[model samples]
Target: MKIRSLAAPFRSSSRNNVLFLSTVFLFMAYATDAQHSAKGDMATEQKIHALISEMTLPEKVSLLHGNSKFNVSGIKRLGIPEWALSDGPHGVRAEVNRHDWAYAGWTNDFATCFPPGTALAATWNPALAYKQGLVLGEEARFRKKDILLGPGVNIIRSPLCGRNFEYISEDPLLVSKMAVAYIKALQSKDVAASVKHWLANNQEEHRDSIDVTMSERALREIYLPAFKASVMEGGAYTVMAAYNRFRGEWCSENNYLNREILRKEFGFKGVLMTDWSAAHTTVKAALTGLDLEMGTDKKDYNEWYFADPLIKAVEEGKVPMSVVDEKVANVLRVMFNTKIFDEKRREQGRMNTPEHQQAAYNAAAEAAVLLQNNGNLLPLHFDKIQSIAVIGDNATRKHCSGGLSSEVKALYEITPLQALQQKFGARVKINYARGYEKQSTFREGNNSGQSGSLNVNWKLIDEAVAVARESDVVLIFGGLNHDFDTESADKQNMDLPYGQEILIQEVAKANPKTVVVIIAGSPVQLAGIVHRVPAIVWSWFGGMEAGNAVVDVLSGKINPSGKLPFTLPVSLAQSPAHALGNFPGSDLKVNYEEDILVGYRWFDTKKIQPQFPFGYGLSYTNFSISQFSTDKTGYGKNETIQAKFTIRNTGSVYGAEVVQLYVSDPLCSVLRPEKELKAFQKIFLKPGETKTVEMPVKVADLAFYDESKKAWNTEAGDYILQLGNSSRTIFQKVKISVK
Candidate 1:
């Protein structure tokens, strides 16, 4: 599927015309539909549809694939100019040739790396997510990239899911709400946004072939909601299908997901493209609602499937002509919505605005969470603290740390070490040590190391211990990286790797007032010193400027306001997904026995507590929860119970607190979690500021999948809603009856 070879079939100008014309015809059909007739905006859409009808099939297909350097001429007659494709969820990967082009690689100069997706989710503020999206859109437009291939919305199913750092949450509702805001903000800026890795794209192992066989109930309830929210609510302009399969069929060509679910059910009026090299069957994909195949070495799927096999299917009635028209119409619709025809984007500058960089910094700052701060260990006053010791491999190197397509070149990255020095020069003594090195760095050949040896490097531990003894306070930075953490080909247990544990132990021994910061992508087991560490910060590979963001929080320049998006597993053995075995393996038939039970849900349902519950995070300032009560006991079937609480900032400093609300189903036909997160509110308060927050819990929020009943409904019983700062700590509760 070389670009040159794929280009051969699409050479004929006449063939390209057919593809374009067919799409126009379909648009006309939709425009004339009774539904559009009722809508007053039919004239504009109809004109664009009519214009699309004049294009040839090859031209239409060319539009499906974005304008690449190898192609983009067929649609010249339609005046569709070439549009460049670029990368960067953290920062723009615009550099022509950079090292491996991954999280650690150098992005082209000018592209600012913001905090990672999980970091934004850590804020638990959709408004902030939207603001970040607006920044990403501005940056993308400046770089002249037509579509920003980002906002990976895969579920954080397991702590071991390597790419979990890039996704939002274990709960679908929160992820959906956050994603919708992000998409809306990005698209509002006129930059095409792609909500990606559609449906059950949870694991990295055997990702290309793994069969995600969850019951339809789980699919709709847990996995598909965020995607639906992004498209249906956010009006995302594009969607990228995953490299895996849903049920028995490949995701690109899966009819249920692509057609029945995404298109018909959810009404996703946008371009549906395949993940790079993710396309399987050509004609089947088109028939199943795939409008485009991206980065395919230029596979002329149109000639191989559409022009020849596609027409043959129509002739033999195996594939309807209407299907081709639908695909083309969808493509045209995206182009129209993007204003691809009316405006030229080349005039826009590339990575020149300080506003963009500031946005990145703001996003990073907002997403920084203070996971644990016992005895008020954080907001380290530089004047009061004379010395600081930074220890860990993460302290030295910048790891964008995740999986496939995670690479991006940051115009400038503020390493934690660099940021600390920049903010507190000569004023504070800073000692540093590398707690661990990449396993391959110590190996003879490519990456390889024994599992037992993959903890904190022992030699590095001794140096860090010495530094900790001399310093006033110690900051131990260590966590998983792509080499040791990811869903890709390489995977590891959810434990601190290679001597990091030993380093933490030694450092804690040397300095009892030590703070531990994790820089991995997802939650990891922190048993060795979970109880010993006075302050613990879970920093999910905070983006290009992550280093600076971490420094800001540590130094009290920026208050830590982020919250945990996933639960920290006490041990790999206790993880629900672990029982299923290494993902995409164990005979390739792994079942989600936990079913709708995910993250804290599984832990609570099975009564297997985690080291840290989901939504757990400590603040530098103290806050108290009071006045907890529901407005009413019970009402109509759809009526909601409002739980109001007044949160007072009792500490001396300003800070933010996340108020979490959970609902419990006392009894049900199927097994259910003891309590599930129904709603949450993040409030920022100054010293002594008290705010009354209200959260509504509706009957619909209590529904669960009852396998025997084969339906989701609220069981008739007394339901309990608990309001707390974390899953394990319930500060307030209210009992209600569902009729």
Candidate 2:
């Protein structure tokens, strides 16, 4: 239905008539609940109850199911309009434009694309995540979308998880903080932020039928923290249950997950929708807290497992009328708060606004982590080089969108070749070659009857090598693409796919001054010839202004400030899940055998050195940390510790340093990681300038989950507070006794 339009008041000449007209307008405002007061929310709550009381049982059932593929039903008699939803986290997706699942090519649906979640997390800047949310939300509001189904808070337990590119981090604390920031910004713009995949949805393999079995300690310590913050702290209005079964029941209808935890514990008063026909039974879904069922059948959205069966169950006395009313009421509350019935309508949003474009550029620039710079070869001077060689398929292809539903029809994308040419027009000559072809899968558009993309041209690699030999310096753009990183099945291995390793080795031999700019979502294995390269940098799937962001860092226009959110292992076998022989279970079961020790935790605990540790990244300038101390040497379990340190930019150029605080428990009841990241701060400084940094350490931060009691316990012992830039690069330590 179109938005309601009100007629203009008559221009009467008489003062008495004008006075009467003004009174009518005031009455109309009060009637529509337009002029809301400070206590309006309380009144709105009462209105939801009142509306529920008036609705018939059939009407209530319709509200709890999808009215369309992307909308919920509303009662026209009560003047309640259906709410619209869009796919999100990164960008307002192109798919949401259509009434069904097909794309509509709607001009108004065009949106400004932002950097991926993995890239945003790589920055280690929650503030940037907030900006990402705000920009994406603004575009969602323009598209007339009420709810954004996004901010997938699943931890990247394995790099090979095809959908890992969409997740934020391997650490729960970082993911929680980042999730909250994004949720707040999105909700502030009147768009409901939907935090998704409620439980352990680590792998896409056997997603629908797989049984994820794990201890309670692991769930509380790792998986559930981010979802808890999303509801209790971030005030997210919607949550999408995962497709996998947590224990024996599906997540959509799991009583403990949907009721005891989410609704009762976290106080989630919003809607809980299933992940596309994930609901197995009507009785469990109705009795539990599953509110709305969407996309169970996208093509024929008219039919739903929860819709007809639910009404029948309610009439048969299996389900109560009160349960149906609660679901309908929750949907109504979201509609009320989002201003769906407001008198004025918002104008359609245009794509590529200056502010939105700048935010995208800034995120990509800061997210590029410098892994290695042996000779300080970066911050390259264009004047010193007469000609430069740029080689790879990634340079020519568009990288603004990828990874399942998060892929976007971006307004425009600036390729690395275009950005480089724009930077050095005629002063420095730039030559580009199609180094190697990245294989695109059927779903990702290739190599089958599905899309027919096949061709591994060694000739192209040979041409790129010849070009590298001629140029003074070379930049190789290579890594995973949409084909390698998508939803459905996990990637085969961590090695750069399809002979890119061979291509990089040949290019490096041709030009010794080769700097490999990796464009992967997760850590890639760079063992054999990677050490031979002078400089190595990892740049994730950057959005619209990625090309510009890359050039800005290379030309000394912007300094690299990003750090690794997850640890980079030497090989797949070294990883915790893989080492335990627990990943990709044979009988449709994935075990959490690592048991709260993931990523850096696994490597640190085992004393196994990684390719690059977590929190590791290099800047253009050097920095030193000193004078580390704590306010107290002893503290009670209830008290907090304050760690103080001084960081100075001890170099000739301005740069930023990430001050990471980790807790080291020497003696504990259970085995613990050597050092777990508790807090981190990113601060910028001028050359030769020093600043004092203080990070407050909560006592709860040092606690371990006691599985026996199902509680977090902080044992009395000597705890070490280690301050550093990265996991392996500890600068100083101050021991404190906790009693």
Candidate 3:
């Protein structure tokens, strides 16, 4: 059994205090259930109450914090049968095979690796994200897993955060919306979506013990929104607490957050599980609302460490039986809702269906955003571009996918070069080169490498340059690989992982007809090359079928319709979150000096132009915005007004547009952000196609956490609502009064 010493301040064990706490939980469990049943849907609570009433102390404690004994069994409560919970946002990982934990296991070689969260959010197509969720969920269910730890909704607080690729954007609104869709679709297939890294857990370095302290406003507005939305909107069935501490208390046992806020305020009626081995202690974790203790340190609950202590506390009236009941009840409620205990169990099978693969492919394709299109350089007709040169080290390597937990052990990763060759065949003479080698050169492992050494192959680059000069068009595949972006730790610099930048500059010089395709996890510093490169495509870690997807977009088989989910910083130093101080340490304090200025808000408020603004992307067609209107009284009394507009695709080619709406409150008690993302809509259009979109301005959306009032409220004021394709360009605008 695992021995846990209580953290300081929480280590109090006076007999009277223990007894008093026991009575509180005992009464709380029963009284709360009675009151809740009198008001809300009591069906779930009713069954829970009945089960708790009959359970022994050992049974109750067992139900509260232990996993299945069997490695691969489904959820079976009554016996020694094990319950399965798989690792997946994209594909399933072998939890049984311990060796594969470091490197995504080779046990399952055929699992489809889907695009990371950053890429999926860029699509701005919630339906496509949902489809991908369904595909992954189906695979998880087939693996006999009750829950899938996925759809990581943590914000990109820092550019140096190693796990940024595994997460969504810096903006909470975008993260929340995407998380909701991912959760909804995953649960739609009867698989529970375990939306994870609960709160304020951004960086992975020292994550197990690091404490994150931030303004409550920043907490509510930026970090917590995604978790709130995932639970309230997406109806997520399980929540995995992060390894970090928030506001001086470990998140697993943070009463203010887990119990008072999440369970009470957010109304998250789901099972709260700890990140693997995150549990600090049994009693403390239980009292703080930690429902499940994962991993094997504690072994079985019948052991001395758990059973003896738990029973002693209960018998002495120190720990309440009601607290145990509530935890078990929550877990049971999810199982009942998901029908995990049903008599007619569904047959376990492989989820390699064509529909699932096609869904994954579509998601990968849509997530590829066209960053720059000078003189309409993209959608190169195969016939017009007779010979194509695809060059770069990443051109043929598996550079599109990131690592740790989300990694894939695929049968094959169809790279951009291979895809180009397959798509164009003999018609295109695609030449490639390992433009640069990894920083960890074969000669020196980790210690002895010059800071700015270039590992370029001059001969190969010269040959590629010649080929590019001869070919009709050139596609230089480049960008950061999984080594540069992993959950294990953060990267040293935001510059391109290796010598790809040099290759891009040199390649562009040799062949002016070159198009740069960046397969990166996060935005990179593209200073000199932005204006020089004729066309730039931001292909963020496209999945297993990435090759086909890229080729389809390049060949004009599919119109590129992806938007930037996060603001593309010109350089890492320009980012507002840069100077906050080094993370993974409590000594370095963080301030909300930027306040609500995140993503496009930072760029707009500071008037700093990004290389490519948020929600900015190019399609094979052109679009126009017109007929803007607003209603002051349409939203009811004391509510924020409404803004509506019409969009039309003027170009002949079919495409999709992400209609973005921003709201600016002119005056407020607290210095609020200049404008916030109010609403967004994705619509498809053919030649001469047009559609009208209306956005309801909720009074709640405008509200800031008023510290004096000790509540969130919207101060009455005049607001400017703007509509456009991106944050930088507000094409249409209207005024609304909030009384």
Candidate 4:
């Protein structure tokens, strides 16, 4: 099982010797299979095994760690090429130095910046997720990158998680559906998608060492589904281990999570690499199924845990040689899957093409959720408006290059102010005012130079009010920037920072026709002005075309169809983790006291109302659902419950609606959420158009993880199918029996 060393004459003494061995291996490989077949092909696996058999121990060890900052070492004599990786789930990140974190200053590294994960999840359209992934894959390949470390599927456990913008949702099913689509599309372009932060790295506070504890039920039901689907369904090529600990063990070396769950249960055959400097041990990590140790702060490459230390461990019998072989096998498998050996045949992806920009625009335009519009104040008519007041700091701030790892060097970013000026400057007199000032700047792992002054600047507020009084319509773009919603640090609280509440309230008071657009990636406190503002829109960090997407929605060119992926609680106290007093925990340990009830589950189960429920969104037009019914009144556990409904666009405009199907088990042996989203479909319609939608829910999917039985159990009982546009707005309910 151990890798055999080269013969004495064939060693690396001179270039001629190395070239002789490379020619011999290449001839052997071609003789075995002239056409290197695809992955899972018997010929391909045989070629990989043949190559591994000839690789020396030193060569195998080199492949387990980085030779450069973002590259895995390759066997030069054997003609194996190095593997290149990049940061970004939404776009291909700009190139950095070969040995450090500094930018490489390459002009050709610019990429198409698409909307972030939260925005993609809000769309509830897996098709858009696939489209975004296609663009990301093309750009990653254009940069000659083998892997794109993205489509972070970690559940949004809390609203304050610094990286919530990079995650999909609070619910596992929703996360799984979106992740599978993103992964499949990315890999289709021959670029591997590294589904990341494996195993419950939910919160960023104390992430490097905080130990997370949760029930097996919670782990199986609320956390593991998305990762499972990514492997089994998406056929993901790689997984990035988290920086935290799960159940008191570092995720990179945790045997239970990596060996038992990911490798054995889900049958993942891909490489499991560390999340930057996440590796801590050598033998245990390798034996426990870790294939690659990507990044560590060690100045010398040989000092890395998976480099010299790993080879020494194998030589001293501290680690088995079979484990090293296994790791190499995984790496080789990815190389073959991505066609590393056949570069000419691989995809020659183009970067920042018009098609790529269109995909980015599609995601941004479809992901803006209109949270409130009391008197139809939105879809602003340009003819009726004489003077328009645009206020806030976010209106002018560019968001394409702020966050640390996810930053993209976009060709150009269209700010809201710039977009508005380009679209409507001649039609209307648009006056601008910086109603609030940013009090902090984000610097990767540190939050330095943050101002402590929370007091409202009366001077700025008075000036904004005066501008609002003179304008016929005021659009206040107020929300968080990268200073608050970023990686490495969670928000201190859910409050609107930098006197934004006072500024928004004063501006709204001066002009009753005020529309507030919250431009942020994560949830923020909206109770301050939810009632005061006549219109409210939740626009996420909309990548390079942020302003264009928001303006399109505001002008009725594109209807707002995006929904809330996670529950927006009225206050921090109403959240499950906070309500149980166990967030970010004490003494470096956190408990999942809320158990399986993470987001809307706890709110609905405890009868606590959220400000906006999961899947909640408003449209410029109206949608009506009727004739909701199930195929049968009873079915076996294996049968599919075909739920059919009729939806119509009742307004005088084109729009889309997400039809959500939730299941309820009123009398389960164990406590289940009041309702769990089993299936959903986003449907588009023209004015007065009716479409019949059929959503199928399998009876086995309704099963809860019965901890007592150590398995999922679908009890034979009466279940209710509730169909609606959102989680809380059920229009019809039909009862079905599972036997």
Candidate 5:
């Protein structure tokens, strides 16, 4: 069966029955194909072993460490090419110096900047992620890079985490589903996709040294799923070790995480590399399943931990020669998988093409979440309004150049102001005002000046207010910039910096037709203006075509479909991490006090109302979910629960809705969350169109990690499946028994 065709409607039960029969036949064919593929894989593994046999010990050690900033040493005599990696989770980062962080100043390195991780997650469409990955892989191949160090899947433990923008979501299932599609697409072009931050590298504060402690259940259930899926399902070729320590040991040298979980449990065969200067010891790191050591900040390459020290350790009988061979084998395996030895067979990619730009635009357009449309003051009709007032510094600031490692040298970045002027310049008048000035500047690994200043410039606010008063409609683009969203440092609080709260309040008071467009990657405090603004749009850090995408959504050219990947708490104090006062813990030690209760899980279980719930977004059109039912009332532990539901687009427009399936075990022996997201599907429909959506949930997936028994347990009891657009908006519920 074609996976893409699964989105099509099944009008009757008979059609569904036919589809199920077809699936059975498809599985039989797939099994035969898998056997043939297994034979091919074994041959490839034998070839990799043969290549390792010819390599000298010194040559093998050279392959395990970086010889330059972004390259691994290769033996020219053996026809082995060097592995080049690019820093990315969004787009191909500009080329840096061979030995330093300075740009190489290459004019040809410009790339098509795509939306960041949070924006892609908001789309809730894995197809778009696959498309974006294809673009990224093509560009990486064009740049002659073998590995794209990207698609960070770390759980969004706290909104204040500096790298949350790089991560996908708080929910493991959402992150897993999106990441698998991206990795599969990227590797299809012969470029390796490096799934990162192997363990809980949640917060950036003291990241290089912080020791993280969490329960086994949290590690197995909350953190490990996405990484496991990335390796097993996505077939990722490389993994990046996080800077932070897991349970008192640096992730680069953690045996339980790297060897036991990643290599053994997940059966990952790819090279595991460090996150730049994360290596702690030579012997420990090499023996713990670290295949490569990259960017250790040493001026002399030979002095790096995995270089001379590793060689010395082996010669002194401290680290076995067999360990060296194992590391060499892992590196050669990825090299063979990516076809590095056969340059003629590898993909010769294209850069900054129209197709790549279109993928970026599609991601940006579908990612703008309509947080609130209180007065329906959106879809600004040109005939109804003549002049539009655009306020706030974010309206003109470009985001493609910030965020340190994820920054892309885009061919061009059109800001909101520029897009508005270009799209509506001929027919409408647009006024602009910089309501706030950025107070900080960010360099690689360093943030200078203060961004937490609450000082408001009265003169700027007055100008913004005057502009709003004269215009027929007001659009305030206010939110955190890279200073608050970049790597290395986390934001101190959820408040909007540069006195944006006061600026927004003043601008909204001037014009009741105000619509606030927040361009941020993470959640920010919206309580100040949520009640005052007529409409609110959470537009993430859109890439090159950010302006065009946002304008299309506001003009009703593209109905908004982006949803919140993480819950927007009314206050930071309400978040599980902060509610327990255990964030960025003391003395370089942190505890996962919240455990499996993260994001919506905590809010729903505690019954605490949030400013906005997870998987929540608004569209110009409306939809109604009805006729929800399950195929069976009782299911065995090995059975799959097939949920069937009918959704109708009742409004007079075209749009897409993400139907979320959340499962709850209300009568469990231990404490559990109110509901956990299991399965979801995004269905697009025109006006008056009805479609049947079928989502399958495995009975095994309903099990909770039992820390006492060190295994997952699904108690034989009643379970409820709730269907909804968002966590808080359950449209229907059906009960079932799992035995």
Candidate 6:
């Protein structure tokens, strides 16, 4: 939080320094009219209009096209500077040194990687999301970035999504709540928060070309809610159109999605940028509300879809001049809002600070979901344990530099081995072994370089078992890495890859007190082995301080409050999306056959039990719910029903609990999910302390998106409001009639 002065230099010339030549042409084009806007003009409507008057048709058109891979041209005549963008949402992407899409290899570009969206969602706390965003925003501001294209909230429609690690959750409410907090915190720094892959972009395979044919009702209910909340509630001013096509049109140019749903309905007030090389045409893209055309070609910037093509159309009267003006105006508005055009530099050098690291650790600690604790084996006593064994592929793997474009150049990352050694110090003995690995591993931690084949092969399973037998307890860190869960390739199956499952089974036999810690973004079918393991921890691909956070929870320094963001089905076939068909669709098309019944809704509706239900996570201690009551039994469309429930820490330990509130429509005109999450709150309580938490359910939220009427409508019926910790664990219920 310190400020220093530095000369405001032009953007680093390494990337788009070629534009310096164009600046001369711009200087000669309107040298007389060229002037900066009045200092501190506040960028009102009048100022935007006045600035637009200075630009020629060609200048306006140039501003709409991709000048570089990640930016649009800026009008020098109007003193509008080009806005720069960073990729990969978890952190500010390492600054690119070359003009081509490559990292700068500079020390300054090494950002502190925070936990991914899936980890954040697991915390079941929006406050933690806010903290993550605040630190992320501060770093982005220091990097001089105008927009942070982040906090991807795409529903986990398929756990097979290679990029599911980047997205938040499988439910709309969980996704929306977390997305809103991140957006609010980032934008508060005056940096535009652009939520990406706007619609039906769940899976990464064939993402750029696959056409997702889903119903409008499904779109409005499951997929659209997160994007809608980010825009309509969180006040996000930027959005990145998804690569996939929805219905028949690409999301970048889908009129109903971009214009009708996003802009007209949700009242989004910013620019819509297409995913890299996503758009195909000028007229369809332009008329359908695609504001800024970026990355039409990944390698070069010459073959643009909007620049020269849009200019000719405007002059030929094929496209109206007004359409061009609106796009230009929106870009300028964002630039002004982000302080890109401001003369005075705000601040600098906020990267990799202590606060950033602390925030990363705090968020990571809260996100570790203790899936199972059999016979009370966890919270290992430091004095009683003389020797420990840590074994697995993820023990040494680097998660931040994985398969996604958001590959982070983390300044420092602590491995599980390093963290345990630091925690135990000279007090306890720790043994380590790479239980299993693959020869052609592409994940960052396995190979010496970024993304490529490596000469790695499975090793040391016997050595791991020997170490486990010698130790008091075996801590097996095994699960998917970037290879099993990353972009461009959807996983073949949900089983733990690389023979880690066999390693875990062997280690469990060697040591009865085997604690299995699975490092992954989503679930790996644990129905078979979970029963055998003494304890199980679902540790996500945590951030830079992941190692320390993991140790803190294991040693009783912190209590695990994280919950399942999605259901852990007993088998892949048990999931409604798969059981109902259309998931992982064939012939280049995927259908969302299970309209509104996604995740827990599917399990609850189908009466099929899952291995671990959504919102289910274990604390070190137990809690009891009592004194459940509601404010009223009847409600109107605009009224809000307040429900109060008491939660007491019944066990002899302090812990946090997530109170999940779900609304059920017993009778309705159309089919609905068995229950839909309305709202939730995360609260901490001392041992023997009882706290009454009141949650409000807005009647408007009760309405379902009626595809026939093309609106969200409510019905007059008796609604059941249930209070519980997990989706299925209903502690209390009350009935209320909607009038």
Off by over 4 Å in 1: 1-40, 66-74, 95-109, 297-318, 344-352, 401-404, 441-457, 485-487, 580-582, 705-712
Residue 266 shift from truth in candidate 1, angstroms:
0.7
Task: Please tell me which model should have the higher TM-score, number 2 or number 5.
Answer: 5
So what's the TM-score on candidate 2?
0.92
Question: Compared with the true structure, what per-residue lDDT tens digits does model 5 show for residues 1-739?
Answer: 4732662566565677767777877898999899888987899889877877888888989999999999999988888888899997889999999999999999999999999999999999999999989999999999999999989999999989988988999999999999999999999999999999988999988888899999898898899999999999999999999998889899999999999989998899889999888888899998889989999888999999999999999999999999998888888889888888885956899999999999999999999999999867888897678999999999999999888889999999999999999989788889899998887666545444444457789899999999999999999998988888888888778888899999989888889999999999998989888898889999999999999999899988999999999999999999999999889899999999999899999999999999999999999999999999999999999999999999999999899999999999999888899999999999999999999989999999999998788888989989999999999999999999987
Residue 702 lDDT (model 6): 92
Query: Per-residue alpha-carbon lDDT of model 4 for 361-398, expressed as tens digits?
Result: 89999999999998999999987788899999889998
| Global fold similarity of model 6 (TM-score) | 0.91
Model 2, runs deviating above 4 Å: 1-41, 95-99, 298-302, 345-351, 444-456
Q: List the residue pairs that clash in candidate 4.
A: none
TM-scores for the candidates = 0.87, 0.92, 0.88, 0.94, 0.96, 0.91
TM-score-wise, the better of 3 and 6 is 6
Candidate 4, run of 10 with poorest lDDT: 1-10
> Tens digits of per-residue lDDT for model 6 on 480-504?
7777667666766677776667777
lDDT of each: 0.73, 0.83, 0.74, 0.89, 0.91, 0.82
Residue 342, candidate 1: C-alpha displacement in angstroms: 1.9
Q: Evaluate model 2: give its lDDT.
A: 0.83
Clashing pairs in 6: 88-406, 97-104, 398-445, 439-456
Give the C-alpha lDDT of model 6. 0.82
TM-score of 4: 0.94
| Lowest summed lDDT window (length 10), candidate 3 | 441-450
Residue 47 displacement (Å), model 4: 0.6
Full candidate order by lDDT, most accurate first: 5, 4, 2, 6, 3, 1
Question: How many steric clashes between backbone atoms does each model show?
Answer: 32, 2, 1, 0, 0, 4
TM-score head-to-head 3 vs 4, winner: 4
Model 4 scores a C-alpha lDDT of: 0.89
